[model samples]
Target: MRPFIASPSNARRTRSREGFMTFSPRKTPTTSQAPQGSPMLEWTGERYLPWIKDAAIAYEHLHRYVLAARLAEGKRVLDLASGEGYGANILAAAALSVVGLEIDDAAVQHARKKYKRENLEFVTGSVTSIPLREEHSFDLAVCFEAIEHVEDREKLVSEAKRMLKPDGLLVVSTPNKDVYRHESAGENPFHVRELDFEEFRSLLRQFFKNTGFLGQRIYANSTVWQIGNAHDARIDEFVIARDTAEFEFATNDRRVPLYFIGLASDAALGKFPGSVLIDCSNELLRQIQEALAWRERQSADRAETIASLEKAVAWRQTQLEDSLEAIASLRRVAGELETGNADLTARLRDATHQLGLIHASRGWQLILRLRRIRNKLKALVTFRVPG
Candidate 1:
């Protein structure tokens, strides 16, 4: 039993406690729904944090593998849009200094807290507008999965080009939009546009030459599809894999998922006017025309060689015919000479036989005349003696 003797305030307080016991209030509001610039990054933090962290480690490991292959090593590097400095740590381990720039303050803070190195420094900045004052500052600049989020991709590329020294190296990686669109149904809201291989190349060729693509695993759970591009005195694209063995090129089909990885530098930009672009099909056609002309010249040279050979063959045939005619004429002359020799031999044999017959007849006649003269002389002598 409860005591009822109490004041109105005390009674009311007791009733409130009883009510509180009977019914619990809802939780206080949180900042979970706060507006952010990139929902993709937030969704990444929520749904893919564990996998992303793991992938980040894998990415660093792969970079080490590349470094082992002597693909890249340096004293200074710029990690553009560095999420949590995992890649920066990897570079700093081998490099003298690594400057990591990120737009996300939370990510920067996390990087500072989790990984601290003497050679690594984290800064908050945007890719399109770099906060650093120095021009052509770093030896290497690397950007991964950040280009698709930029509002002005061209400006971002220009800024990246501006940050590099004359021969500085730039490396970048992005998603394979074909795979993402087909697998995720184009649900990534932060992606302004899903770029196929051609589209991606077109965007990169503006600031880079020798551009290439690499396919990589983003979260390591999804299908492997990220691109890595490099920029230096000349633009290049690195092969993306655990081995970094294969490289991306123009012949790659868009139907198969692929990413753009490339290099860029001042020399590459200088050669950009001659480089290939998707929108500049006419320019490509012109290049094709030049190629065709070169081919025609080659064909013409081959034709001239063939014609010269044919002419030689024809001249040889003519010479052979003349030689054959001369041989036939000589054979005819030999036959005529043989016939003349046979006739002369026959005539000489006939004359010799006739001369022999004549000599024999004359000798016989002389013998007979001599015998008759001897008989006449004998008769005359006998008659004279008788008289």
Candidate 2:
């Protein structure tokens, strides 16, 4: 229920600046006095989508309007299965007038009171059996998320074609069966039947010779989803009759779509509407905050780790400095020992050289010869006297 300012992407903007979520009609009917006696209308998201604050239901409602508003410029638009009248109100901002047709009378009353616009009105009618009296008449007809609920889809499409002029355009959207029922065997209580991408395209081709296809409900790496990002896990198909030429309409649809939106006309549609960034939601904002908090925690953990590593490195550096000092001390002692050994070796060599020189001199040799001759003479004289 918070106010949403439209994103700046809109080239021809109207409601973006209003800063309100919805627009309603004048002479508001009393929902407070709705028929307790007459049986209150079914206005839940299950039966008809509402424009409440909950993002789960509100996202598609916003996206569909974003798409419809582009084709509705200055044209009289018929909104089939226009539940709750929010989309119709959105269209009226750009279109000349919008007629929202819902099957439930109670819902019709709610739409009348809830939304007010000069060119917007609501009525109770089924898509299969349109109450309008003319064929090929209106400028554009939009049926979003209504085809699955009806039993006779062919009759419903034919009725929409009947309401549109030969040169007019038809914009429609439906859910992709594959993605919706991928996890469940049980059927959606409101839907009579569902169709996949190929089956739905086949159905469209029967009525309109010229058709173009577009997809919606795209999602990427994040759990949050937005239009114009990722393949539509929930397909939104956009198609136009190949001949819708007043506008050159183009679309970027995934081959496997989650939902489908299309344009049907005798001519090609106009160029794709101006690119806009429409990503405003409570749930998306919540997720973004959570992600930021997680990053902060991670950064704190990294800083703690780096500090611990720095302390360890400093300790190792101190140990290395101590080891270097010890090695220097040992080298000094070894150098002193080498100096003493060199001095002793030189002294020993000098003494041996001095003794050799003394022996080589003549007087030292003569003293040794005289001692040998005197010992020989004494031995001879003692031998002769004894005989």
| Candidate whose lDDT is highest | 2
Worst 10 residues of 2 by lDDT: 16-25
Badly placed stretches (over 4 Å) of model 2 are: 1-43, 47-51, 183-186, 220-256, 270-277, 285-387
* Cα lDDT listed for each candidate: 0.58, 0.68
Clashes of each: 18, 47
For residues 324-368, could you state the per-residue lDDT of candidate 2 as single tens digits?
898889989888888988999999899999989998989889978
Candidate 1: where are CA atoms >4 Å away? 1-72, 217-255, 267-387
RMSD of each: 31.4, 20.5
Predicted candidate 1 versus true structure: per-residue lDDT over 1-387, tens digit per residue: 001112232222211111111112233222244223323223232111212323332343344324422333655788877775666777777777888887667778767776689888999877778899998877778876667656577887778878887777677766677675665532443444556767777877787665645544322111222246333224333333332565333332332433455555545432211121122234334655777999999999999999999999999999999999999999999999999999999999999999788768978789879999999999999989955
TM-scores, all candidates, are: 0.45, 0.54
Top TM-score prediction, candidate number: 2
Instruction: Name the TM-score of candidate 1.
Output: 0.45
Candidate 1 shows a clash count of 18
**Could you tell me how far off, in angstroms, the CA of residue 20 lies in candidate 1 after the best superposition?**
46
Query: How high is the lDDT of residue 199 in model 1?
Result: 70
